[model samples]
Target: MIVRLGIAVRYDGDPLVDFTPMRFLDRFVYRNPKTSEKNARKGDKNVFRRKAYDPLGIKKLAVTSEVSALR
Candidate 1:
C-alpha cells in the first residue's frame, strides 16, 4: 500500500547568519537608479546627473528637444 504525506510550511526570520553584507551587496550590485538615489538622499527628476554636480548640477538638457508623449 502507498501512503501520502502533507507538506508542512513554516515562516521564520532570515536564515542567513550574516544579513548585513547580503543586504549591502544586493544594493551595491543589483540596485536600480531610483532606489539608489533615494537611499543617498538625492531627489528624483527627469534628468539624471552624475557626481560633481551639486546644487544645480542637473542642467536642463532636454528643454529644447522634449517631445510630448501624449501628442
Candidate 2:
C-alpha cells in the first residue's frame, strides 16, 4: 500500500485543512493503444495492462557492482 500525504484546498472560499491521506496500490493499470482484433470483436476494445518494476533491486545491483579502474 502506498500512502500519499498532501494538502487539499477549495477555491470557493473554503477553510484550509492540515493534510489529506490518499491510499494506492503498488500495481498500476493502463490502457494500451495496440488492441488485438480478437479482443475488439469480443467487445473489449481497450487493452488494459500492468507495469511492474523494482527500483530497489536495480539500486542494489548498481551499488554491488565493481567500479571501473580507469577512474
Candidate 3:
C-alpha cells in the first residue's frame, strides 16, 4: 500500500450533502481530526503529488481522471 492517498477533486461547497465519504475516508486515510480542514486543502489540492509511481512505490505517479472515475 502507498504511504499517502491523493485526493483528485474538491468536495467543498456542498451545504446539505452526502457526507458518507468522510466516514469511509477514516478507514483508509490517516486523518488529523483537529486540523483536517487545513491539511486536506493543502494536500488534496494536488491529485498527483503523493501518489507512489513505481513497482516499489516511488514519488512520480501517473493518474488519469478515469482512475478515480473507475472507482
Q: Top model by lDDT, which number?
A: 1
Q: Candidate 1, residues 1-71: lDDT per residue as tens digits?
A: 12355656564666474468877798788866555656457555535566564444335344454552322
Weakest ten-residue segment in model 3 by summed lDDT: 53-62
lDDT (10s digit) by residue, model 2, range 1-71 = 22365656446542343222221221223434565677768885455655455666435455445642222
Listed per candidate, the RMSD to the true structure in angstroms reads 14.4, 16.4, 22.4
Q: Can you list the residue pairs that collide in candidate 1?
A: none
**Shift of residue 27 alpha carbon in model 3, Å:** 0.6
Writing each residue's lDDT as its tens digit, candidate 3 over 1-71 gives 23377546555656454457776687658855454575677766554467554653332333555554565
- In TM-score terms, which candidate is top? 1
**Which segments of model 3 are wrong by more than 4 Å?**
1-19, 30-71
Error of 3 at 60 (Å): 29
Please give the TM-score that candidate 2 achieves against the real structure. 0.17
The lDDT of each candidate is 0.56, 0.47, 0.55
